[model samples]
Each structure stands twice: as C-alpha cells, then as structure tokens.
Target: MSKSVRLGRGVATAGILGMLVSVAVGAAQADEVVKIGEVAPITGPASYLGKDTENGARLAVEEINQKGLVIGGQNVKLELETEDDAGDPRQATQVAQKLVDDKVAAIVGHMNSGTTLPASKIYSDAGIVQISPSATNPAYTQQGFKTAYRVVATDAQQGPSLADYATRTLKVRKVAIVDDATAYGQGLANEFEKKAKADGIVVLSHDATNDKATDFRAILTRIKGEQPDAIMYGGLDATGGPFAKQAKQLGMQQKILAGDGLCADDLSKLAGDAADDVICSIAGAPLEKKGKGEVFTEHYKARFGGNPVLNSPFAYDAVYVIVEAMKRAGSTAPDKILAAMPATDYQGVLGETQFDSKGDLKHGVISLYKYVGGKQTLLDVVKQ
Candidate 1:
C-alpha cells in the first residue's frame, strides 16, 4: 500500500476504536441504580397498613422502571429497600439509620406519626429527604427539618375539620375525648379538643389509653357516666374498631368521632354493626375525588389484587413526587433532591402537591366520612 493511504487507514481505525470506547462509557453511565428506602410497620398490629404502604411504593418503582427513568441524562433504575418498623419509634430510628447507612437516595415512610417523628431526626441529620405518606402530627414538619415532608394534611387541619363536622352536622353539644397516648393519637386529640372548644362544643372529658389495649371498658364506663353527646377516639382502626364495638355493647348511643387512623376499609369488620355509628376524618381528599384517583385505584387493584387502604395512594404519590424532584434536580443525590423538594408542583394520584416552608402540604384537604350499611361513606371534603 502507498505510505499516505496506510497512514490514513491507521488513523481511521484508531478513530473507530475511540468511538466504541465512548459508547461503552456512556452505556455504563446510563445503567445507574438508585436506591430508595421505605420504612413502615410491616409486622406488628399495623401490618396491614405497612404492607399497603410497601405495595404502593413498590408499584411506583415498578412502573418507573418499566416506563424507563432518565435523570440528569443518565438512565436510572429504582430499587426499593423496605424495612419493617413495627410501628415503634425506636425501631423506626433504627430502620432510618440502616437506610442512611445503605445510602438510599431518599425515603418514603415511617408510617405512623410516632415513628415518623423519631425517624425524621435521623434523615435530617443525614441530609436525606424523608416523605411520610400518613403521619399527620403538625409537629413532624414544625420541627424545622428541611428533610421532612408529608403528603397528607396535618392534625392541625384534620382535627378542626372533624370538630366542625361534629358541631354543625352531628350537633355534638358535649363530647368526650379519648386518645391512644401515641404522638399521632394524642396530637390529633389535642387539636380536636382545641377546635371543639372554640366551636362552643363543650368538652366533657378527656382520657388516655394505650394503642395495644383491646378493651376500653374502664374508659367507656367513665365516659358513659359523663353522657357526652358524642365520643371522639383518636387512634388507629385496630383499637378504634373494638372501642366503638364495646361502646355500643355498653349501651352508649352517642355517635363516635375519630381521625384518619380510625378510618379504614376494614373498620366494618372490626366494629361489626357498631361501625355504622362512627364518623371519621381523613387528612386528604377522598381518593375518588382526586384527578387521577380512579385510574390509580384501578391500576393499584390490577397490580395488588385489591383496593388500596388508607394512605396507599399517598404513598404512591410520594414516590412520584420524589422522582419528580430527582428529574428537576437532574441528580439522585439526597441533598439535591431535598433542595428541589420545596418547589415541587407534581400532580399525581392525589391532586397537585406543593409544600410550604415547613414541608407541610400548602393546600391540604380534610375529608369527613361516616359508616352506613357497614360501609365507609364520604360526607364532606373541607379545604384548609
């Protein structure tokens, strides 16, 4: 071959090899794995709720992966690391530490307010974004942790909504209050008490109970004596269910008021016919009322083989919110995602989600529900 032709062919060969190497490097960069942590009470009394939360997050991750995700010009695959906190604060902190150690990009939960509060400190210290799907205690955001955020309305809004419904709709003149003594139950009860009093509904009595207690006869007996027009129980459906059933057995004819914890699909099974007399409030719009609520429910049922319980939709929305933050930040780093969170305006299964300075939802909605024919029926949706 001629010397000039030989030199040109060699240069061309080197250029092709360089191009191949660049493509390989780009392929490696595109196959990035992003880990997300999910902590919930997956084992103990609140297993049903925790499992539902996991399902919602898992579904979101699956959909994202299937549809493909590209963040910062890099293809990202999501992996969910789920841990069971058992609805305990101590365990929740431990789970938070583990996720931090594992270097997850963000976290989706620590379901209950009790657990979420303790876990929030760990995430804040680690500079990771922690989004709680169901925790409603106003203190969760009030702690001034930029890392903390929630999709639902706070007890500050929920309690007042329930109080308004009771005063105007139920005409509850005198109402007795009870709490499970956990942060969630106590915080909600306290907010309700404050609002109920402001609305001129006389507060008859307030009592404390533990979440594990299956029987509330002692408190029920004391409450019955007070003859309050209504009874407000601030706790989960697990305890609230039996509490309502026992109140009926004790011949207490007053309607029972409760917060989101007591509002669940299985309350009818837990309280039987007594479920009919229970009125409750959820800290967000009814799922059916959201823009994408029905479609999300259908997709959820198709994937999970049943309807979503309380907060599952919220959990699902949390995942999308986190992913949207990642897209906006163009990075999966926790700090970047946290930085992008405050300005989030993603619309998901829930309506538009935006956070205030305190990481609380800017436009929160509280929905009231009642039971009829052993089914939870929506009464009203109040914007707060």
Candidate 2:
C-alpha cells in the first residue's frame, strides 16, 4: 500500500481507540454510590460515643472503597450518611425517618438502647435494615422486628452474669441499684435486681435518676445510709463517671458495678481516681483479648488517634456485615440486604459473628472489666 493510505488507516484506528477510552471513563464515572446510614449521639453529652462509633463506620467505608469493589459487574462506591440523635429517643426516630427518606441501604446506629428501641420501629416500618453497635436491652431483639439487629449481647445475659459475679464471687449480701430512667438504664437495673434477688441476695434500694442530672448527691446520700455491699449503676459513661466520683467523695467504699457504657478509657478521665472502684460489663469479649481484636485496636488507634470508646469495633463489624450482605445479594437494595442478613456468619474483629432468628448474636459474650491504674482491664469473658 502507498504511504498516504497507510497513514490514513493508522489515524482511523487511533480515533476509534480514543473514543473507546472516553466511553470507559464515562462508565467509571457512573459507578453506583451506595449510601450506608449511621445514627448516633454525635452531639450533646454522649457525643463521644457517637463520634467513636462513627469513626469505625467511616473507617470501614474507607477501607472498602480503597479496594474498588464491584457488585454484580457494576463498580460500586460506599458512602456514609451519619446523623446525630443526641442520645434521645425522639431525635432517634426523626433521624431514622430521615435516613429512610434518604434511601440508605443499611444503618449502623442509634447508640443508646432507649434511642434504638423507638427508632427501630421507624426502620422496621420503612423496611430498612438496622444493626445497632451498642444498645444491649433484651427487649430490642425480643420485639420480633426482622429489620432490627444488634452485634452485642443483651442486658438479659449481661445482668444475670453480673448478678452471679456479685453473689458468688464478690459475695455481696446487699446491693443498691440506681438507674438513669432511660430504657437502657431501667432495663439493666431491673434485670440485675431480679437476678440478684433470685440469687438470694438482699436488695438495699432501687433509686432512679435522670441521665442529664449532674448532682446525684441526694440519691447518693440516701443510698450511702443504706450501706449496701455494692452499688450497681445503670447508665452511660457520661453519667456513670460522675456517679462513681460522687460515690467515692461520699466515702462509699463499696465496689461499683456497671454495664458496657462505663467501659471506656474516658471513664477514667471523668471518674478520676474513682475509676478504680468501677467494675463494668461489656456485651462482648474484650476486643484486645480477641484474636483479631488487638489488630483492630491498633488500626483504630492509628486512624482515630485514640482507643475505641465503647462499641466502635462492633460498629466497624456492623458495616462489614452490611457490605457482606450486599455482596451476597449482589445488590444494594434494602429488601435484598434484609433477606441476606439472617444468614450472616461473618468472621470479624470479634471472631465468628452469627445471628439468630431474633437477630441477636448467637454466641454472645459478656466480658467483665475493671480499671487498673486508671485503664480499663479485662477480668473475665462469659459466653451466653
């Protein structure tokens, strides 16, 4: 062929190649964006709780995106939509509805049980899958909401375990209970009181307080007179820290027992020297003690510049669970994610996490811990 003809053919081939590259770039830009919602107390007193949980979810989203995941032959990008509930039930419902309206594929939040329980109905009604990272009230899972699930053990298991430890191990004959009047606080206190009484221990008094109360002097003073062997507090770390501080100031030498809410490093900051008096129970095994937990802890600290407060690891796992479901269903539709949730047997930072028919962790773990040298230290792990 002549030089002119060969040059013309080469130019045509180059033009076709450039056109194909532009089409590929257009397809890449059109990648589906999957939004995962997170509802927690990102403001108010429990903002730390919400922030910690959000960090985990954010981290998971980042890690997943880094891998450039593809679902059903379509390139996908995961996006996080976080809402602050201020740890309030009414606010949680509003946030839940907003997320539903935003059309999120799944949600991981409403950190407190009180918030989670009421907000759960909103998610359920809208058919959005919700996996709470904290919220341990047994009623949450027992309500028979197919869309509701939690990654932690419930108060039913945590309460009985704590009661057994007090009666059998601590040998406490008398106990005083104080709850913050929230669903989480009241439920935990009630369950502990029942189990303690059933174990043949004498109950001293059951006191109630609001979660926002700063001065617990009156209730503390009244309970001081009772001289109970141990005082069990049913509330989050925000209140729990101050409660322990006041108890110590009152010269109440009795040990303090509480739930997972008080198991964070900040508890020591809030309680100061009084943190050592606290013995708290978490809904799952101590993350540091788990096989993969230490690695997660290191990664979290490196990314967030601090240790995880409460259920951050679970929150991270919750995000993974949603993604796993998405992968299994080969779609990001809400109904498809819900359908794939029941068969979730995810091996995460916490180990093999399987859900039961009620959307509760099948092999739930309730780990007990105490503050040693102003740091939370794991004492025991109970499988329920």
Candidate 3:
C-alpha cells in the first residue's frame, strides 16, 4: 500500500524476468545448432574421393546457412562435424561411433565400399541416417537398413552396363578380369564376368589383388600371357593407375575398363601417359548437366586447381538429396527423414534422383567415361 512496498515489488518482478531471459537465451542457443556428420578420407589413398564427397556436404551446409533454416518455425544452421575415415573399414567404424557420440542427425561418407558397408551398420544401430555419395556395392542397400542410402548407382546396375559395353560396343571376345577383392571390387568383377561370359565373351584369366599392394608385375605377366582382347579391372584409382601404366609397358593391346572407383584426378596423374585410352566408367555425369555441376566444377577447379573428378556431381547430388528429404519431412529426425527420402524426386547434377523402399535410388543411370589426354570425360549415359 505504501510507496516503498510498491518499489520493492517492482524489483522482485524485474529479477524474475531476468531469470526467465537467461533461461530463454540458453534454449535459443541450443535450437540454433544442428549437427550433420561427415566421415570421409581426408588422408590416405582414397582421399581424392573422400575429400570430394566431403566438399559436397560442406557446400550444402554453407548454402543452407546462407539461405537460413526453417524447421518447425525455429531457425537453425546446419553444423558439419567432419571425421577422417582414412578409407579403412575399421576406421570407418570408429568414425561412425564418433559421429553417434557427437549426436549428429545425419551422416554422409566413408566413401569406399569396404568402409561404407561396415560403417553403415553402426550408424543404423545408432539410428543415424547416412547417405553415401560413392559407395556402389549392391550389398549396401541390401542390408535392409532403412537409414542407409546412396546417391550413386549400385554395382548391380553398373556391372551389367559395363559388361554389355565391353561385349557389344568394344567387340571384345576374350577378356581378362582382375578384382581388388573388396566388396565393391569383387561384386563388380563377378557381375561383369557372369554377364560378359553370357554375352559370348571368354573369361580368359581371373586374378585377385590386395588393395594395399603396389606391385602387380606378376599379375600383369599373367594377364599378358592370357592374350585377352580386353581387361576388366575392379579396383580403385590407386591400384588402377599403376596397373594401367604397367599393362601398357607389358605390351598388352587390350583396352582397360574399370568402374567408378577407378575414376580419379590423381589416378590419371599417377598413370600419366599410361592412363590414356583407359575406358573408365563413372557413377555420375560431372559435365553433362550445366547449372549445379558447373558451379561445383568451377569451385573444385579453383580449390584443387584441376578438373573435377567423376564422382563430384554424385557427391553434390547426395547433399541435395539429404536436404530435400529433410525439407519434405519438416524434421531432421532420422526415421522420419529416411521415410520421406523415398518420396524426394529432386533434379540435381546427377539427374532425377528418387529412392526406392530399399534405400536405393531408382531411375539411376551409370555413365561410360573415357580418359582422354589424362582427363576423364563422360562418354555415354547407360540408361536401363
């Protein structure tokens, strides 16, 4: 009732308001951060592919931040916590655990098939959704984990296409097959051998190699002795590079063919003149589409100071795919986002991308690429 009593009440109310403001500030900061996991090879032999894929995830986050985020009427910025897997399956598992511990809503990476398959299981167990940009092993999606997804075509699709091209287009009757013995290499080699033989092409010699091995002179001698018209190699850019150079020196006339893993900027540089005429097929068309692909390529060239690698567009598409799924779901919750992913049909640098129930992108096409002048060029899109 008195002036002092009224003044005392005012101070108490102001203190209460300040406390509420402090709590609100803490909550606002919490809502402002959204973590996205990115695991890839920042170092090691597979760094080229992993770093390129990492760039896509990074670019998406940057674009999403610049444009502003709108999720459930709350503004948020995507935060990327990138981990280096070193292209090792064991390291991939460790990275997956680290991302789960960090509480990232989604993951992108562990580029190699060997790493992606093993790491995906850990992510699935942790309820984290991961979309691999370049892992093409058919078993990846076949694992029945709804949280796992990929932007690139699987080896099942690419293998038959590569084999058909080798038989029908290249007109090769006798072929030698070599696989790196990893999930991707073995699966692709098996498919190509089966299909090539069915197409009346002889599987003259079949050989296996370890990914870590640098010496292949014995294998090259064996392949040369077979006198095959063509060589179908199932391996990464690292070994493929050396094989190309060695095969050329061995006086082999067989044209070398390989899958997406063999396509890399560093691979061409390693093989030098030996990389010429190596008919390597890539997972996505890096130069076919103009808008997004060109922007990515320009940025990549500026950053890396050379032409963009084959999987660059696919990596870019992987980001677009995940972002579109999140937009459609209106939530970054892993289950909801993965469910909504099947409905996302976005036109990206890799073309129209739509996922099936098995977490595999339907309507996907693998393009045949050729290395000319030490530059990988998209030759044709094998639509099936």
**TM-score of every candidate relative to the true structure:** 0.92, 0.91, 0.88
Which numbered prediction scores highest in lDDT against the true structure? 1
lDDT of 3 at 141: 92
True-vs-predicted CA distance for residue 330, candidate 1, Å: 0.8
- What tens-digit string does per-residue lDDT give for candidate 2 at 2-118? 999999999999999999997667447647988999988989888888899999999888888877777777788888999999988888888899999999999998799999999
- Candidate 1 residues 97-202, lDDT tens each? 9999999999999899999999999999999999999999999999989999999999999999999998998888999999999999999999999999999999
lDDT of each: 0.93, 0.90, 0.80
Better of 1 and 3 by TM-score: 1
Of 2 and 3, the candidate ahead on TM-score is: 2
Error of 2 at 103 (Å): 0.7
Q: Which order, best to worst by lDDT? A: 1, 2, 3
Global CA lDDT computed for model 3: 0.80
lDDT of 3 by residue, 116-135 (tens): 99998998898777888888
